[model samples]
Target chain A: MTQTNQPEINVQEKRPLDTGTAESTSSEPRFSPQVDIWENDRGLTVVADMPGVNADGLSIDLNDNVLTIHGRIEAQNPGKKVLTQEFEVGDYYRQFKLSEDIDKEAIAATIKDGVLAVSLPKMAPAQPRKITVVQA
Target chain B: MAFLPFFGRNFSGSFWELEKMRSHMDHVYNALADGFNQIRRNYTGVFPLVNISEDEDNLFLTAELPGLTADRLEISIKGETLTLKGAKTQDNAGDETLNYHRRERQAGSFSRSLTLPVKVKSEDVGAVFKNGILTVTLPKATEARAHQITVQAQ
Candidate 1:
């Protein structure tokens, strides 16, 4: 039996997805949500904090080695006069560039209580394999 | 309020309209940051940000707490102050043999208290937790409630 060593797991550039520069006068603003990424032998896992975002308002897409996560928050402003407001209502946007070692076809994402979790599985060969040693 | 006229103008009047829109977007974006700065200025130590607004009868306070369950939270009101306390737990802690490449999420206990602008009826306070945000509604005290005034002409 032989053992295969997976290439160094690397998580590349985390930034905002460049949609376009053609700006429009939209009242709604978009802010980059905070995210935490963890990795193990299996693959990479990304968790994002996106409060006020529901399942129906979130969209995750992976294209051209770039993973994009977008969340739209419904405006919670009541018709009553707003005496004090400390936070602004806006959408959440973030992007991550995936490496070739990641199996894009097997990527899965789930959201619970406004927290988004995306798991990127490693390729078959990248999985850790156990090899038996022969008696010398 | 002054920007209303600019928004009401025709879109094709000139190229400056595009510039106006761009600047307006910048203003809105900066306003968000400014709001955060204001909160930080008022509250010194608070894990999650909170917003407080009031109507004639009820005062509303909202806070964003992602991944926190209602069962782990506690809310109380005393006099004119509202208090919130909770402990946030980190997920995937049971596995002791796994290697982690990066860990940035913080987990711990926190307590926050804020003084309400007006007296409230603590007995009628109600709260709702949904989508990681907590909204607490405090009914105004009878003496503190807003009252309409009428003018009579002799």
Candidate 2:
């Protein structure tokens, strides 16, 4: 296995979605969930953090080589008076453009514990071949 | 390179330049915001961002902790203070051959403590972790709850 330096973990602040440019019709606030992506020889993997979003509330869409991930989180404990509102509960929306080497048809995804992982397999590279020289 | 994770390296040359400039601007803006937050909250950028709310019966504290199991988390409340501690480890840490393209999600131990507004029944506090969200319900103490006063007609 190739050796790689371990990344230092630090607390990352949440970024609210820019509703002005979003295509979604809902007026509810949305956030951009943090993600980790890596590529190996075989494929690329994307892991996203989307708390409070179950499998039923998540949607992954691909169009014209652009992949979009959206997760909806229903409001929790409604009608309760907020005391200390440090963070807001909202939906998650993010999109990415994939490279041409990826095989879009073979893409797979799974969601567990509000974490979504997506696998994008790379198209097999053309193998070089040697041709025998023949006198015609 | 630190901001490259925000935008992947799949854009064209000209577009990539624009993205890089945008990321630089964002970095500056974020730095300024962080400075302000340090002066105001003194506890900004804490892990597992939380929200506290209350109803008539119980006080609810919710925290977003994705990819963490119940066993990895520890929640405790003493007096009017609640403390949450947890560790998040990457499942793919053993795979060093993989080349990371974008890595914004972090893995490490985090702990946060907050003081409750009102008194709660320490023995009756209940917590549930579902869909990566941890919700702790602390029932209000009897003396802290609002009591109804009956009207007497003379």
Give a tens-digit lDDT track for model 1, residues B1-154.
4565665556445446677999999999999999997776555445555778887888888887778888878998899988887776667877765566556556666677788898999999999988878989999999998678898998
Docking quality (DockQ) for each candidate: 0.20, 0.31
Error of 1 at A105 (Å): 2.8
Clashes of 1: 0
Docking class of 1: incorrect
Error of 2 at A109 (Å): 1.0
Q: Fraction of native contacts in model 2? A: 0.70
lDDT of 2 by residue, B39-61 (tens): 66545646667888899999999
Highest-scoring model, DockQ: 2
Tens-digit lDDT track of model 2 for A1-136: 1113333335566788765764767666789999999999999999999999988898999999999999999666569999877787789999999989999889999988889999999998899999999999
Clash pairs, candidate 1, are none
